[model samples]
Target: MSAKRVDSTIVVVAVAAAIVGAVALLGVLGQAWMGYAPSHLLTYLPMILLPIAFALVAVALVRAALRRRQTEVGQS
Candidate 1:
């Protein structure tokens, strides 16, 4: 992959991870609606996932910005 290239898949995966994390947390809190309590491990899954997801998204944003900047610079 080129230094200035940003992968849309990476961005999409990060967003999905974040959403899954948020949903997991909600599921844990809303166990009553779920009809069963989630295991502790499942409850902790979101805590472990959210930061990684956010970090990936941050990296994607920075890469996309760099790529855009390079494109603009090359055009000038």
Candidate 2:
């Protein structure tokens, strides 16, 4: 729908990804330190999610900046 809505959703997703990634990283650590074996998906989730989170945040920021510029130009 709206740019604001898209931005909000992107931010929410980014936060979720980061949280999940952190949890997965902890699982990985537990596996290494305490011999708690995680599944293949869990073991690799941090690698996937952390980068996605970073990219999503960057996209959200750029989208926000572009939207702001568009609004400013429209008002001028």
Q: Largest lDDT belongs to which candidate?
A: 2
Q: Which runs in model 2 stand beyond 4 Å of their true positions?
A: 36-38, 73-76
Off by over 4 Å in 1: 1-6, 32-38, 73-76
lDDT of 2 by residue, 1-76 (tens): 9867988999999999999999999988888787767779888899999999999999998998887777754543
Give candidate 2's whole-model lDDT: 0.90
**lDDT tens digits, residues 16-66, model 1?**
989999988888878857788787966887998899898998888888788
What is residue 29's positional error in candidate 1, in angstroms? 0.8
What lDDT score goes with residue 45 in model 1? 79
Give the TM-score (vs. native) of candidate 1.
Answer: 0.71
lDDT of 2 at 47: 93
TM-score of each: 0.71, 0.83
Q: Candidate 1 at residue 51, lDDT?
A: 91
lDDT of every model, 2 decimals: 0.81, 0.90
Error of 2 at 49 (Å): 0.7
